[model samples]
Target: MSAVTELSIVLQHDIDEQYQYQPGEIIRGTIYVTLAKPTAIREITVKVYSEGNVSWKGPDEQVYQAQEVYVDSSKAIVDTTYDIEPLQLPQGRHDFPMDYILPENVPSSYIGKYGNVTYTMKATVVGANSRDTAISSEPFLVLRRQHIPVLAQQPLSMTASRRMLCSCSFGKLDIRVTLDRGGGVPGEDVFLQAELKNQSGHTVTAMQASLIMTTVFRAQSRSTEFRQVVSKKRDEMDVSRGEGRRWTHVRLPLPPYVPESKLEFCDIIELDYVFQFRVEMTGGSEVRLEAPFWVGAQPQGLEVPNNEQAGRRIHKGWTVRGSQALLFPDGGPGDGENGAGDSGGQQPHVEHDYDEGWGITLVPELRNASEVVTNPLYQHQQNHVTKGARDIPEELLENTKL
Candidate 1:
């Protein structure tokens, strides 16, 4: 008879259709086991661990690499002799709850062409008499949050030059490249602006820009780094002697599924990104420039507002105005003057008057000579008016007034 009829593992919650967890998060699950008949078991153990395997082809041979476990936990649910009371075999189903805390510093789970970082949970039931063990295993995902570095906040720029000599003739080439910002989130575009100056005798061939991903692996005290070009865009140009060309803005797209910069928690593996610019010459060496940058998690609370809703409201307001104009022709219902019809209907405009002490001020107006005399500034200016006039004006005014 089979020692264990069925074994299964279940997690508490699903992370995007798969079990995903971050560092320092508790992973809670249950293990189920069933037996066909009553049997004695030595032990039933549940274990959680993570492993990374990296393999690549060297110049002459295939190299295999592995990393230390980022997390490892083992618990024995049932032990025959070690229990306080002797454990008895059961024919029915049994359930065991399992809980494990991931370490604070652990690398984000990754799967690559030559290597992978993975997490798994296993349940094993060992029979007392037989050497065979019934086992079930499951895998989960680990994602680490990336913090943007200060360097990523600033723009990145670099210049490169290459010279060539042919048949006692010499020529030089210069290329300058710049990025708007050093870092970006996935699914966003990184704009590259560049200028190429060709003082060389050879005609310019082509200019290219590429996004490169570098992965570093360390094993057996030996470290190896590999570079892959993830995305690339190029422009063809022909610049003669003393001629220059410029690329105002060339966009390179970032893949959403790519991992962030420097998987910090993992000691053995690291990831980085760089923008590479290449300038090819007709008969000279290519001038290449590379600027390192970072890719990180999207910042929280920076979601874009819903412009569609705003646009709908604006369109609705315009439509309402147009409908009112079409319906009334001259004016709308609320457009009447003082709420009175044009046909002599008495409708006085309503006005609200507050109490006098309630922050209200009144100003008096001057009309005749008596009222004008109360103004001191006006009297003073009236006396000075004759002083600036011609000498005969006062005599003429006195005779004419009399």
Candidate 2:
């Protein structure tokens, strides 16, 4: 019988492999081997082996194996070896380049824990003239796991952001506008004073800002939407300070484009407009803020609600005259849900008149029997238009130095 020969192995890798590895990353390395001395050998086969275990108590109160997993022959060298009869290297030195592919399911193992995975390559050689075999195993680590103590001792977070629905709290902003009816006549000029306030702490940088007045009618059965352009609104304010304010003055000239015959009374009249804001720093991120308010008719002699304020009114016959001059720009209202507001279906209607093209007016009829008016139509809109700017009066703006 022949004696078993000794084998030595060394694995080498570079430092650029860490910090950039993915879950399914493949680890690669070379197995450099040097034979102890020239000896008779048939072939050298390399095998990668690994095992994972879990502990459990048996019925007899003794520890038992709950899980035992293995990965063998994971990688190998088919017919690579130092055979004594075939082109052998000198007796003093011998080397062979070998590799084993890492298995995708290999778990990370470290220290003495069996839950961690380890890789070992063995070079086994069969004696040419004897019945003996030589095998050598080298230990290797898969991936190091983070220390378990730190993860176990960390405390849970309890911030407001951690609470349910707390993340949705961007707060509400209030925009106020005053349409002076003193100068407005059957076919004269109308003046609008608008104030925009940034109620939220975040700065709003919009792509395009517009002050528009729209006519909306909503009922339990159906709804109609329309708008009137008051002015060519732009986001002229670079940084609307948090809880700060800005103002704009607009004048409009009305023409009798719609005949007085087309007007009718409805349950509600909605005047809404949208201001598109985008991240000026990124040019790619954008958000559109819509400011909508409304006015209602009290059925010729009905009392206005204690919470309601007078907006604007026109004779029933003038509705068609306004409709005849409606001008909407293509891709004006925007597209999709993110384009403007909710993308439900029918395009948003823009209300405008071309009598003299100076300014525009939005006159809407309320559906007398409608019960589906959203709370924003009655509460938020009213608050935004009437009381939103009381805290910051005209005197305060006039007295403050830039």
lDDT of 2 by residue, 1-402 (tens): 334434555554433222211112222344333444455556656666665433334356655432334456532333434433633433444555543334434444322211222456566655454454666776655431111222212221111111111136564334444444321111333344544444444444542334344444433333445555543434433443344344434444432111111112112222333322222212333334443222111112222222111122221111211333222352222233422333554554443332321133322222221332221111212335655555432221211112
Error of 2 at 234 (Å): 59
Candidate 1's displacement at residue 369, Å, is 84
Worst window of 10 by summed lDDT in candidate 2: 156-165
Query: Which predicted model would earn the best TM-score?
Result: 1
lDDT top scorer: 1
Residue pairs clashing in model 1 are none
lDDT of each: 0.63, 0.35
Q: Write the per-residue lDDT of candidate 1 for residues 49-83, one digit (tens) a residue.
A: 88776666566575746666776767676767565
| TM-scores of the models, in the order given | 0.57, 0.30
The RMSD of every model to the true structure, in order and in angstroms, is: 30.2, 33.6
